[model samples]
Each structure stands twice: as C-alpha cells, then as structure tokens.
Target: MHIPGFDTTTIGVADGIELTTAMGGTGSPVVLLHGFPQTHLMWRHVAPILAERHTVICPDLRGYGASSKPPATGPDTYAKRTMAADITALADVLGLGRFALVGHDRGAHVAFRAGLDFPDRIDRLGILDIVPTLDTWNVLHGVDAAVAFHLYLMAQPPGLPERMIAASADEFFGHFLDIWSASPAAIPPDVRAEYLRACRDAVPSIVADYRATATVDIDHDRADLAAGRRLTMPVTVLQQDWGSALGFDAAAVWRPWAPDLHHSLTRAGHFMAEEAPADTAAAILDLLDR
Candidate 1:
C-alpha cells in the first residue's frame, strides 16, 4: 500500500534485497529511517513535508515491511554494521554519494553505526529517543529492565518471542502505540493496523535484530568506546525526559558521544513519529537547517 504522504518506488540491490522506498520532491537528499515494529511508512507524515524542499528518501530497512527478509546468515548478518551497510548500499544504488540521516529506535541504532562507519558520507545525524547501544545495555537494571522486557526476551534462543508475539500481534504492538504517546488519538485505526501487520511479519528479523544487540553490537560499541570515537556531525536527539523513570541525565550522557547535541524532552512516548509528527517533523527540519 502507498504510504499516504509520498510517492513510492522499489530498488533492487545485492543479495536480491528489494527495498520499498517512498521518494518525493528534490534538493539535498535526506534519508529517514523508522524504528522497530514499523516500516518506512512511519515517516508518512514527516517525509512529504520535508520533500517539498528536499529529496526525501524513506526506505523499509531490510526485513521490515515490504523490504526483503532473507533468512538469517548467522548472528553477524543481523548486526547493526550489516544493517548500516544496506543503507549505504541503498544510497549507492540511488547514486546519492552524500545525504543527511535521521533514524528512530531500531533505525537510530543503525544510523549511529552508519555515522561512525561512513562519517565522510553523512553530513549530519539525527538519532531520535535512543542512546548508544553500550550505554543502553550498561544502564538497564531493575525497573529500567522491566520497561525494556523486549530486549531480554528477544535475546533468547529464537522462535519463542516470535511465536508468542504472533499470537496477539495487535495487542503486543498496539499496547505501545497506545500508551507510549501522550495522545492516544494521534494514530488512526488503519495506520495502527498497518503497523501491527508489519510488526507481525517482521517478528523473526526483529528478534534477530535485538539478539545482535546483546552480542555483536555490544562488541562494536565497546570497541568504539575504547577508541574514543564520538559522532563527528552535528547531532539532534529527541527523547522523553526519563529522569522520573530511568533516573539519569539523558542529555548529559549523549554529550560525550555527540560533540554538538540538541536534546529536547518531547511529550510523546516511543512512537514519537506517529504520536507527534508535527513536533517530530519540526525537530527534523530544525536539524536540517542547523
């Protein structure tokens, strides 16, 4: 289905990975990445608004939505570096040598790695509502652990989380879609169904994605920490002030990783794109200007 706001196209890259992309308008290329349990359609509200002024390219990251979901090639194939490689490959396939990158949740994890691995190609980076992989793993315990049950659950020995989640896909995904935001009415019924369907279809890949976090991703982050490699581009972060819950200075933590950081406490929950697209789009546009 065509995501409401933008024109859609498909690009066939290596390994026969056919990526579904929503492209529109023109100027400097701005690549938008969506979080987990969602698709490129997550940017439906924001992309076309930016598309009027920039070339907005929003693609379904591998194993999500209409994107190719090849069988896992081992633990390594699901790593953030491998996923980031697909983004670079997409840019190459489209002849975009340089572009701005924005990603949220799972996509943000890939974006951070992409910025570090291909700093020369990315002009600016916007990571929505996430910290570095190592930081997240290092920080979670007790109540914080409870909030992130998916992390530990998916890291288990396969098939289990996928089967359990597939049982009541709507309830599993829709629970967050309803509670994560300050407003419940933000996402309409059809959009909510689409998100749930995507989540159901991508369950295995999603499990593999989170599992990589506990293994290969941690190694990568620890290596970067050891090397003192911080983000070189100007960075903007939008997150809920989890001080009342997670009990840490969210912005202060990001400072060491992002030299120039723009941190804001948004009213929405995890699905900030759908919950607060106006604010989300505005934040993205503000970063684009910066």
Candidate 2:
C-alpha cells in the first residue's frame, strides 16, 4: 500500500487538468511518465533514486490516476502529440525549460512522440518496453499480434471498446498488473485497487489515447519517416526478449530510427519499472550522461 517514494503535490498543467504529481529532492529536472494501469506511483522506486541528485517530477499522465480527465474532444486531443504537449506545458508551468524524459508502456509511446515533436526540449530520452507506432504495426503478424492484443482491442470504434472496458474495469486493467509484472507480489491489494480505480475513471481518455494510435500516430510516423527525422538525442531502450521468440531482432529494428541507441533485453516483463528498477535506473543515468 505504501509506495516507496511518496511525494504528493498537485499542479495545474493544462486547461481543466490539475495533475497529481510526486516531487522529490531538487536539482536538474527529470520528468518520469507512468505506463497504463499504474500512475506516478509506478515510479516510486526509480524517481526518488534519481531525485537523490536530480529534481524528479513524476506526474499521473492526463486522464490517468489523480490527473484531471478532460473530455476527449476528438482524435486530435487524445493524440500522443497532444499528450506530449500536456507534459511540456506542465514542465513550463513548473519552470522546466528543458529536461530529460523517461517513460514506460503507454507513457513511452507519448515520450517517443514528444522526442520527435520537441527534439530541442528533450535532452535525453529513455523508452521502456515499446517500439514506435509504425514499427509496432509493421512488425505484428502472427504470434507477435498476440503479445500486443490491447493495441488491436483498444483501436476499435468509439463506444465499443469503452463500453467493454467499463463493463469490468478491474479485471480488464488488472490483467497486466498480474501478468506483465515479474514480481506480482510487489503490487499489493491497495495499490492494485488504486490502479483499477484510475483505469476505470480514465477509460474514455485511455481509449482515446490508444484509438489515436490507429490514426494520428500513423500519420505522425509517416511524416517523420518522410522528413528523415530521427531522435538526435541519446536513447536507451529496455524490453523483454520478444524478438528471439518472435524471430526478429528488436535492436536491429530500432537502429534505423535512433543512431545512438542502447537496447537491452531484460528478464523482466513489460512492467520493468517495478520488476527491475535498478537496471532501468542505470539505463536512464547512462542515457542522461550521453
């Protein structure tokens, strides 16, 4: 129940959005973004550790956890570009002109979009357990499709996915809490309840977030590819060994987009932040130094 690094503070990031954030220590800024089915609490172990020397700002991404759930105006608002805009706006509100960015799962998708959108603002980027939108769609075929079922499921038409997810929110969101985590024992009852509640509340925005993936994300990636735009900043990627089992080298796939890429395959599952914070933190520091 007690998250290791607890520092609750609210910040008005955007219109009608007051994000619940956890700030620790004080120094250069390092914004930590949480994945799905979790919150700023997911960074409990990693944030404070980084906060030992840096000002760590971990926020519950828009429509997730304690953050305000604004109505999804359309695909534009829920686009990862818009979500990334929220983060940068939060940084500006907090007086962070530029900073390092680290994100896991859904957050990582946003971070990748942010890096492409605001290359100057992000000094270093660490994307945990994910590939780019174009890569994700291009790679999925047979068994690979099974690993990323949520991408397909959430990409459905308007009210269908939302209705289904809302029907059994806890069971829907808690699936990852139990499976993606190597040490499911680490996430106790209360934390799991909180995660479920957050997911339940943000279902619309969360669905919009993924739904944008099928549209705006594709357009964004195509534009970037055509423009020959790649992340100039150093990038560290840590993910499971899905490539070997699926018959593709994940790193080989990443090298084209990121010239300075450090890819590592971990024993942990998708939720590496909780399962292997030490390694995640190490990879983050390594990226920052570059």
Candidate 3:
C-alpha cells in the first residue's frame, strides 16, 4: 500500500482550503488528481511507477480525502475554475513552473478546465474516463440518464443532496466503489475504507462540487464553446466506449475541444486507472512524452 519515495503533506491552496498531496521523484513534473468516490489514493497502483521517472504528484481534490473543505459561498466555490486555481497555487508552493497533468473522473473535470484556463502552466494533459461536463449534460437521455443517476441526484437543489448523502454517507459512497470497478478486488479493503470515511465526513462539500458542475461549470463550458477557447495543449483521452452508451461520437465531441488529441477507448470500467494501472500509466507516460 505504500507508495515508495512519496511523502504526504497538506498545503493551503485556496481561500480557506488546504489540499493534501503525495509527491516524489525528481524529473519533469507530473501531477495526478483523483476523482469522486475516491481520494489521492486512487492513484496507488499508478503513482509509484510514474515516480520512477517523473516527479509524480497526486493530490486529494478539495472536499475529498484529507483536504480542508470550507463552506461553499456560491457556485463559484466548487467550479472547476476555482478548483484549477487551487492546483495553480499548489504548483506555486511546490516550485513547479509548468507540468504535465493527469486526471480521472471529477479530477478530470478540473484538469479539463485547468488546461483551458491555465494553458501556460499545464503543458500537456491526460484525461481518463470522462468527456467534458457540457458533453455529459448534452447526451443524457433514457437509459444513459439512468447510467448517470448520481449526476442528476447530486445536481438537484443543495439542501436535498447534502441531507440525503449525510444521512447514509458510507452506503452512498461505497456504492460507487463497488459498482464502478470492473473487478471487485481493484480497490483493496483499506483504500475502500478510507474513501468511505472521507465521503462520510464531507458530504456537503462533495455534493456542492457536483452542483457547481451542473450550474456554473456548464455555463463556463458553454461560454468557452461560444468563444472558441479550445484546449491547445497536447491531450490524451483514455476512456470507456461511452459513445456507444450515450449515442454520440466521443471523438467528434472531443475534437472541437482538443485541437491536438490522442483519443483511445480503454477496455476498463469506470474506475479505469485503478482497474488497469499498467495500461493507464503507459498512456500517461505517452501523454507527457508527447
């Protein structure tokens, strides 16, 4: 379970928020961000190898894991733009000028925005198992809508999600861990416990993150499309064939956003990085090398 050579520390990255990071290795910097129903530990299998050559940095996105999650004032608090700013601050504190970034799930949500907002700082990006937030909302219907029930559930008015999740936090969080992985053993027992613990304590902040995506985050994406602000950096998107499920050309959907994109359909489940670490790490290295 130990990530060789990596050390953990918490750093203040945004207004009243502190991010917990696991960083090591000594070459070109590579930041790895975790997604929903998980923590920075989601990268447990992939980070050590990446640390062999690159300075792999993994952080618990605010509101998850050990990060400090302050009260959300408005939609902006959980907006990817705000979350991306936190990453910029973390880089500043770590003395990194520019770096390659890899994100999975909700973390990918932030990475996509970071690539768009801080093009100069994020040199290249690798996104696993997600398209843009706008694309997600645009494609929801019938069975696909059922596939993403959590999206609609958490996106509802703040009070409802916060209360419902808090009432059965461990059960709610553990559901994703059990259902999303291709194999039940992909997430070991201890790691699964940690995810449940974190989500149980931070229900409000976690749900706010989802709500912001439905509101302000979508607005930002739509505005970017209108303004034609595409992700200009080298991008690699490794994902399940969601196009088949959602009935949209995933490549065609990403092409407009990523001018230079290497898109591949991964043969793993929703939790691809953990389910297929070797393949995911190779894809990440290829993204950075590109």
Best by TM-score: 3
TM-score each candidate.
0.95, 0.95, 0.97
The Cα local distance difference test for each model comes to: 0.85, 0.85, 0.89
List candidate 1 segments past 4 Å from native.
Answer: none
TM-score (C-alpha, index-matched) for candidate 2: 0.95
- Candidate 2 lDDT by residue in tens digits, 1-290: 33455577788867787888888778888898999888888887787678777888888888788888887788787788888998898888889998999999889988998999999899888998888988888878886689779889899988899999899888889987887888886777877888888888889989888889998989998999999999989899889888777777899988988998989989977878787888788888777777
**Judged by lDDT, which candidate is best?**
3
User: Residue 123 CA error for candidate 1 (Å)?
Assistant: 0.6
TM-score of 3: 0.97
RMSD of each: 1.5, 1.5, 1.1
Worst 10 residues of 3 by lDDT: 1-10
Q: Scored by Cα lDDT, where does model 3 land?
A: 0.89
